[model samples]
Target: MSKPKSIQVFEYSTLICGQEYNGHHFKKAHFNALVKLNEIHKGNYFTIGVNKITFKNYVGVLQVDGLVIEILPKIDQYESDSESSKIKWQAALIEMLRVTKRLKIKEKDEASVATQSKHLLDIYFEWFLAEVQKLIHQGLIKQYYKETSQVKALKGKLEFAGHIAKNVVHKERFYATHQVYDKDHLLHQVLFCALEIIASLTKGSYLYSTCKKVQLDFPEVKTIKVSAKTFEQIPHDRKTAPYETALAIARIIILNFAPNVKTGSENMLALLFDMNVLWEQYILVRLQRAQEKKGFTIIGQNSKPFWQNIAIRPDIVLSKGENENYIIDTKWKNIDQSKPSTQDLRQMYVYNEYWNSKKAMLLYPTNAISSEINEKDFVAFQETPNVKDHHQCSLGKISIFKEGRLDEEIGNTILKWFETSKNE
Candidate 1:
């Protein structure tokens, strides 16, 4: 069998069948699979049009049978389709995920993989395999599980009813419930299930051999059906803590995997994430790490009741000393010269009043291809006639990339901006 055809598109881009897109056609099977996948996700990943599928804010790789759709982030809309642009955004997305603890990759392993040209999904597969290998090297943990079966020599408690029912014909066998201690338990079962999935999806990829080798080392545990709730119910302690990272990745792969069993041609696996939520998380993590040394407290999604049974939460709240507080809300989109939306402004205003913050700002990522809006001064709301104090909001932009690499100093840069604005 030949290798699957792969195509790349940025988030919010459209793909249609026939010769509409660079002579590449989107097969009806693939489109149908995406539609079904969207249905499974409640239509959050993409929107289906007449004959085309337009991706939404979610960015990641989606595999539908023989077609792999690599959806890159449209951080810089101008050069979104360029090869270099895709690599840059891919690296940025992966780095952000690492910082946010979504993807667990050590610094040395990440440095080695950073130089290679690989799809985001493949990179994830490799990372998961690496983690599983580590666990295997350290030895899989074992636990006691109950098993019920017929045995020639009864070693455990015999099931009287079952023995009477089954062994009535075969008097030599005993039906018994026994406790077996081994590596074939829930944790390993989940890992094995995910490995089966990876084996099916990663054919012809470079990571296939490594994945298969890892599977050989892994115990052949009983396969069990798992859901999001199944993962949530998994108990963690010193014995099972090492399985956390591998199990997390397995949950992602197993939950998103949609197998078309009838025809076996429409199977799809979607590992997409919302860029908006990612931006918020990335900002929070960066600020938390950077502000720790500055003697400032950074809180994320701090919520307060707004009205009856309603609450409001700002993205980030910076607190220093006793009475100084600042609010920063990160937006994933780029707003060049346009004024911040009235709804956002009003939200920030409320955040200030409720949090008793001295200042608030709408933080945005600067366009990678161009400089951001020049305004740095805060725009104050119209004060009431006799009010003793007023609140202010500003449009803040932080450069996302510097010299073709992710700017690690973004947190410090934002902190500098806050200090400068406060002094003025």
Candidate 2:
């Protein structure tokens, strides 16, 4: 698919424990619209991603440039043809931002636009999630749910009344009342599926400083903040690109936080281990084996705009070299943190089927915090009837050490995978 024709950002909104909050507060929603939107999306019931739960720092009125995920603004305004946000969360976000006037970029004072505000940064996330909720509500998503309310007498005696009297008495009867619970299960399913892709895309964090290398100019975007002090401290030179500060931070994160890479494939895991670069970096490392021609392009055609195929993008397309090419996607989420709801594992299989890959692997972070699983043993768990019930398996060993020593740690692990593969 080509890029979406129209997109704009709006003030970001958030939900925690079932209440909506605007860009300003954390405990609850200030705006009625956001509250209504939260209910509509059932945000309380649906989680954002495993990483959202896994990675945490302090959050206040804003998402700091180096700390939280920065939502990118859309290029243009989109029309709201439907009252149903379920049909279009992006449009709703664009519309929502339009109401706030945060989406507007000043040609006159571009530098301030980049550094001064966090509204669109907020809107981008809200809009994206809203769009998802709308899609699930459209009825394309199907999941198993059964809940029924039981009608019982106030006292011990069972009560039966004639149809006419029953209406007056407020009587209802059911032989069985299975509690279907809330309708948000399907929404969670959708969110997690989207979450895996997005989380994997960015590795587990959404910090802009980690989005790209420092010094790389982000066109169309003015700035995204992860922290207040960082934002305030960045020099505001109009001639310099807005992301310059983010880029510089990204560099610090790279040199300090990420693993060391010696440029190409042999040492690319160093880049992949860097928490900032890991998301897209891991995907890139896997693609090194692909020939430009005669192979499936995991990211789609080179020209395909980045966000167009965000949801269903295949992880990898094995091409010419192998007899059987399989697509592989890595996820940083732990099923323990964000358990793999049926929808999650299903989407992984779906992508594999969509690309007609002979086999596929949904590579998880496999942290020791997760469990002590050896690689082969973990694969065997997949073959088990009820895999979720059993958490002890050896697929591969994964453990997390201090951030400073991460380079040495990750490098050793990658070396192990390479060695193990060679022996096999």
Candidate 3:
């Protein structure tokens, strides 16, 4: 089997006609698949132009037909299409996901993912395979499920209507509804379908053989068509709790899969995520981990009612010693410290006011080309003529990568900034 062609492009970058990027040709078929995908997704992922397709803030892998497009996050310093930069940013994105708990990588597989030169899709496929293998080793759970069928002998309760309708002439057959305890339930059904998809998509890749082996180990399950709602209808209990991670990954694979009935080769699978949400969660998780040791309490998406049936929430709120509260709003974009957006400033101001925080800071990720400004304070606004209370806001920069790796001490840095400002 021939390997599917792959292309690596940065988020918000454009792919034009006649462009061969990273040794992969941006062919017309690939473009057509993309257009069809955009139409299916209502143009949320990227915008299609006459001869070019420009990506949006989403960063992940999208495979259409025989082509795979891996979208890496764009850091200002690594704006160019350099192989080293691609590897760095790709690792950074995966690390962020792992930290945020979006991708669950076991400690044993961490080294494997780090050492291998797999694309994002392959990494995801391997993760799914690992989870399935673990479940198979530990044993897939069995549950009592209702099954209605025609049996030779009497079983559970008999459905008189079904019995009469189907077995009028055939008196030997009895139609009944029975409760059977088995591993062939909805959860395994979903996982089985996802494994089939992985088997098809990972062909000619390093994970193809392992995926096939895992599929062979999985129990035979009834093949049923599932939609997004089908996953939502799944019930969670002690028995189903262990399958959470596997089910989550399965949901991503099964839901995003779109098969082209006409040609069968233009099948599409997109696993894209909004970089903004990921950044916010990444920052929140890091801050909570770092501040837990201290006496500070960190809350994410802390919301309060602003109006009738409306609320205002900040990305993060840090409270220490009960009297001091600090607001942090994370932005994924790079901006001049001196020229923060008016809308953002107003939003921060509102957060400070509603949350009763003295200091509200707009936190941004810093890169090589970003401004030197670390934490620049915005002028304080007086509450009223008779009141002595004042509200202050600042624009702060946090370095996302340290020595080409994710900076795990970012929360400590922010804590230091708050302490220093308090002393002054």
For model 1, the run of ten residues with the poorest summed lDDT = 367-376
Q: Give the CA lDDT, 0 to 100, for residue 234 in model 1.
A: 84
Residue 16 CA displacement from its true place in model 1, Å = 0.8
Give the per-residue lDDT digits (tens) of candidate 2, residues 1-424: 1211112122132233333222323222212222332244345312243112111211111222112222221111242323232123333233323332323333343323224333333333333433434443443322345433345533222333333344454445423334343433423332333232222223333322232321122112212223334434433454334334323323322222211212121111011111222323443443442334333434421221335565466544444344543444555444433455555556555654455444445545432442332345333224447543322112222333333112223323433342243245
- Quote each prediction's TM-score: 0.92, 0.29, 0.92
Q: Which candidate is the best by lDDT?
A: 3
Residue 2 CA error for candidate 3 (Å)? 5.2
Q: What digit string (tens of lDDT, one per residue) describes model 3 on residues 1-424?
A: 5556888888989998778987877877777777887888888889999978999889988887667888989747336778777877888888888898777666465546535656677877878898899999999988889999999999999999999999989999999999899989999999999998888877888778999899889899999898998898899999889899899999989888877521245567888989999999999998898897766799998789889999889999999986899899998887643468889989988888888888988888877532233334545755668767788888788778888788888888877777777766
Candidate 2 deviant stretches above 4 angstroms: 1-313, 318-320, 336-359, 366-419
Q: Per-residue error at 178 for model 2, in Å?
A: 72
Ranking by lDDT: 3, 1, 2
lDDT of 1 by residue, 1-424 (tens): 3445678788888888543343347777677778777887889988999878999899878777656788877655665486677677777777888888877666565545436545667777877898899998988888988899999998889999989999888999999999999999889999998888888887887767888899888888887888888898788998998998899899999988877521254467788889999999999888888997777899999898889999999999999898999999988886865678989999999998999986898988876442232225766777868877788888887778888767887887788777777666
Clashing pairs in 1: none
Q: List the residue pairs that clash in candidate 3.
A: none
